[model samples]
Target: MPMNLLHRMLCRSALWERTSATRIVPWALTGLDLGAAALEIGPGYGANVRTLASRTGALTGLEIDPGLAARLRDRHGADMTAVEGDGAAMPLPDSAFDAVVCFTMLHHVPSAAVQDAVFAEALRVLRPGGVFAGSDGLDSRGFRLLHVGDTCVPVPPDTAAERLTRAGFTDVDIETGTTSFRFRARRPAA
Candidate 1:
């Protein structure tokens, strides 16, 4: 099976963990208000969707896999809107979301160009001063291989902050302590 096909299948499994409340709660406490309308890239199993929806007024999930998108739709219904699309080329307009969240989907995206495009899209859709945070399995001493279908990518942290900085995000902060690295960035207020 192709890697994309495997991701599609995994998106349906409820076992996949979502956002880390322990990590997110502190960020929220620091005055990053997520007002309403958040956009989540690759919300596998609707974990982040549940977390975002609980805090924000509305949430939208963009997923490349139809199976996962459909499962999310069936599970979330009207509370969270799930759309089938690529993160690198989102259909929404600029500054469309109060915040943008991408979690555990970077390694699966092949090529640096695609990563740039996705980061650009995330920055484009976010409101000024809006928060953008995500976690990716990066290069660590105990790095493990995550088999997403037929493709296996390095589950180690890459240059996510540099990518975000190039995309015009400011105040970029990255934390890489555990097996995964979490990135928290802010869009400069205009």
Candidate 2:
């Protein structure tokens, strides 16, 4: 997904990191345990990576952009693994992680079909009973403005549960705020 200059700048800002640490990450991962191994679908600018790394035993960030992936590896390789890959078709092993998550990056997948593929991939890579959770910006004026020249196809919260279910996840839950939405679901142990 291509992000405009302003959007890129905003994502890399200190304010974004603070918000991710104090609010977004907390809300997205509430009441869930990431366990020993966790995978982050898209770790843009590592805004949420620091908090995520602290909570899980090991964190692997799957980034679509090669440059960003390299940068992440360079900056946080000691703490987390950063691999260049797509969320819809992750280059990881099946049933390999205790948790898989993405944050504010779904809409960048270009279309709903691709987003669903990402969901399926998440399920495929997670261990039974593993959690798949994330948060994304809802359609809003500010959100639209922020994505001016970027690939933005907002996910409708109303249909998220169904989509997650179709992707073979159970206990799907979605919560929408004024500007964003959070979703949590788990792969059935049986």
Candidate 3:
């Protein structure tokens, strides 16, 4: 499904802003080098761009929504580039970025297979020793209600570290909160 008005509002709300700033951003950036290049997959409203841009030497966003991607290009034009693309099958080059991160959109993928594909793609794009990190809502009743029919297969934090490891990542770490979880892992060094 496309990004509707309700989704846009939710992404831009104060609660969303705080959550991204405090919990998500810090966790995702846990072990990343601020001077390295980074890419964010499925950035619904580019909510994570500002923080990521401020830290990373170069930043790009891969958004599924063409219109939203264009808007992101306009809004954060100087800080980063925003391209329209799919997470499971990106058009990007291999080992191009020092880091790859995603927000709560993994569950929005059509299937668990696609979600796993996204993790593999994320690992594939990371340079050796680079980070692949992100956060997502827990499969709680509230989260399910909010996402409604949009969520495909919610990945609980308990399984995230293993998933990352299976996708060729190392040093996997996952922190689960009451209704959300953050994860970070690194591609093996050469």
The candidate maximizing lDDT is 2
**In model 3, what is the error at residue 167, expressed in angstroms?**
1.3
lDDT value for model 1: 0.72
Q: What tens-digit string does per-residue lDDT give for candidate 3 at 92-132?
A: 99989988888888878877778889999898888888888
Candidate 2 global TM-score: 0.98
Candidate 2 minimal-lDDT segment of 10 residues: 71-80
Per-residue lDDT of model 2, residues 1-190, tens digit only: 8999999998889999999899998999998999999999889888887899999999999999998998898888887899899999999999999999988999899999999999999999999999999999999888899899999999999999999999999999999998899999999995
TM-score of each: 0.81, 0.98, 0.91
Question: By TM-score, who's the top model here?
Answer: 2
Off by over 4 Å in 3: 3-5
Could you tell me the lDDT of residue 154 within candidate 1? 41
The superposed Cα distance between candidate 1 and the true structure at residue 101, in angstroms, equals: 0.2
After superposition, the stretches of candidate 2 with alpha carbons farther than 4 Å from their true spots are: none
For each candidate, what is the lDDT?
Answer: 0.72, 0.93, 0.80
Stronger candidate by lDDT (1 vs 3)? 3
> Could you tell me which residue pairs clash in candidate 2?
none
